[model samples]
Target: MTISAAFSNALSGLTASGRASGVISDNIANALTPGYAKRSLELTSNATAGQGVRVLGVVRRTDPVLTDNRRSAEAMSLNADNLARFHADFGALIGPSDNPGSLTNRVAELEASLITAASNPSAPSRLDATVNAASDLAQSIRSAGTGLRDLRTRADRTIGQQIDNLNGTLQDIEALNARIRRVQLSGADTASLLDQRQQLVDQVNTIIPVKIAARDHSGIALYSEGGAILLDGSAATLSFTTAASAEPHMTQANGLLSGLEINGMAIRTEGGASPIRGGTLAANFQIRDELAVEAQQNLDALARDLIDRFADPAVDPTLAAADPGLFTDAGAAFLPADEVGLSNRLELNAAVDPSQGGNSWRLRDGLNAAGPGAQGDAALLKAMSAALTDPRALASGNLGTGVMTAGGAATAMLSITSQASAETEQRASFAAATFTEFQRIEQEIGVDTDAELQSLMQIEQAYAANARVLEVVGTLMDTLLRI
Candidate 1:
């Protein structure tokens, strides 16, 4: 080749080697960066005559199929994790079956107190103890109800926060899309912009399950798994009105609770059956609307059973047909429609409450008797004890349609809690295993430091050889000019 042509080839070789080395260095530097794909320099022969090489563009190493799979797995893992956390919290609130503070233990204590009072109906101390136990039982139900509502409120607040974060992320993605398009049009390197976009996509995936679609000018559009468009040319809006507090009666059916909105349209917030499924937000919705509500209903049912036990006309003949029982609903008779908040409203009958100007001897008499009857009359105390042990059908769908004693009802509630906790834990384990496998696959496709070093060595050699050629060419030109 002529001297000038040789110079041109060597110069091109040096440029290509420099670019390759730079790309290799970038790959090594970002080896541990999350969502960073390794970069490689793409080179091609120049079609023009006598041109040695050309750098076409920068290529990012990635497995789109694996990336999509990982995103899906990550969403599932987060969903299951949220569910497991809420169920575990519920289990803690109810406590273990053997725990002294548990519902069963409280009821058992009340039953034992009744038996003692019945055996010695004239003893004021035993009567006082029996009344105290009954009061404690009512307080326990109220505490459980309050806890369930508080959990629901917490879930509602978290859902609102998640929606806000999701909206912000969508806007960021939209901005990146515009930036990517502009860079592509300017024929500049868009690799960095692509990496930033990938990171944002990963962030959004944890909030809601989405399907990505490539658009024109290197842009992307996102759609929910339920086919709702989350983003297109612009970011879609998400809205949620958070409640300051939650109550058992503040249900969606009564319009006292808030639901999700997507671009001014209502969407389901139920559970797996909801429009947006398989993410942390959906899981929170399920906890707030389904799990917590069911727990409250079961508690209210137990409260209803307790009230019914003391309100039976045969047990207390002085009580009118509509009179409040030994255990009353806010000191009044329980109406079926008021069952929603019965646990929270349950109270000991004022006639038997010492703090309410009532006497302990009244337990042996009647709730509305003219005065304390014969103190040795143990019939009323014995009947109350027997009522607690008698089997009756519960008023809660959570326990299924079945007959059970007060103690049995407590057992059923605990069984429901244990089963739910176990199922959630199992799902979380499976999702964790699946996510780990996907992450491993992604790591395999990530930067290989050894391979990058090897490539760097090759680039160094090429650079050195090109520098030698250029030097030789300059030397030959100097010699020719002297001659």
Candidate 2:
């Protein structure tokens, strides 16, 4: 071969080797960078009759199927995590049934106090203890009701934040799509832009669980699994109005709470059938609209049962049909139609509350007794004690007829809540496990510093070998000139 051709071939080899080394260095540098794919250099023999070699530019390597799987798993994990957090907060509010301060325990205390008062009905201290216990019970229910409403409020605010993030991400993706198309048309490598775009899409996936559709000019369109189009030609806008606070009577059904809107279109914001399902966004809405609302209903029903039991004239002879019970709703009679916020409004009857200008002796007598008939009468106190053990089918709560007394109703409510929390936590664990497996598989395909370092060694050898060939070519040309 001519010295010129030899020199040319050696130069091409050196150029390709240099490019390969650069790729290896880049891979090693970004070994742990999230969303960064490993870059590979392509070298090919020249097509010309006596040409050497050519560099075919760098290619980014990623397992598309594996990436999609990882994204889906991550979305499920996030959804489960949000739901689990809500349950944890709610469970903490009521506490375990075995806890001393739990709702069930509070009811048990009230029942015990009633029995103690009955043992010596005329004793002011015993009657006072019973009154205090009942008051404590009402306050406990009110605290729980307030806590649930607060959770709902926080959930509503979180929804707004997530939707805001979603909108911003979609807009950024749209901008990136345009940039990627421009770079592609100019025959430039769009790999880096593609990585950024993928990261943004991953963010959206965690909120709405989307799948990508390849568009023209290296652009992409995103669609949720629920058949909602998040981005086609442009980013879709997500809108939500956060409330100042949440209340039992405030609900999405009654238009008091806001639902999500997508690009001026009202979409279902809850459940598996929602347009944005299986993600953190859906979980927050479920907490605000479904879970918290249901909890309030059950609590109100429990409070209503307590009030109705003491409202029975047979139990309290002085109480008329129109009067409030020993346990009053907002210190007034509880109307069936106004039971929505009964738990929050439940209070001890002011007529028997000494702090409210009444006497504890009212417990031994009747709430409406014009005057104290008998100071030593234990009959009313015994009847009041028996009221707690009376078995009656509940009126409002979905708790089946099996629960007989007030304490049983409280136990049943706590049991239902705890069971739901356990189930959700289990789901969260499984989803997290699945996500971790997919992440491990994806990481296996990501940049491997060990492999990259090995490749660097090979590139060094090729570069040295190419340099030696060029040296030999120069020495041969000098010898030929000397001849």
Task: List the candidate 2 regions with Cα displacement exceeding 4 Å.
Answer: 48-50
lDDT tens digits, residue span 239-302, model 2: 8999999888998888999988888889998777998898888888999998898889889999
The root-mean-square deviation over C-alpha atoms between each candidate and the true structure, in angstroms, is 2.2, 1.5
Query: Which residue pairs does candidate 1 place in steric collision?
Result: none
Please report, as a residue range, the 10-residue window in candidate 1 with the lowest summed lDDT: 394-403
What is the C-alpha lDDT profile of model 1 across 426-447, one tens digit per residue?
9999998999999998988899
TM-score of 2: 0.96
Instruction: Give Cα-based local distance difference scores for all models.
Output: 0.88, 0.88
Model 1, position 211: C-alpha lDDT score: 90
The alpha-carbon deviation from the true structure for residue 148 of candidate 1, after best TM-score superposition, in angstroms, is: 0.8
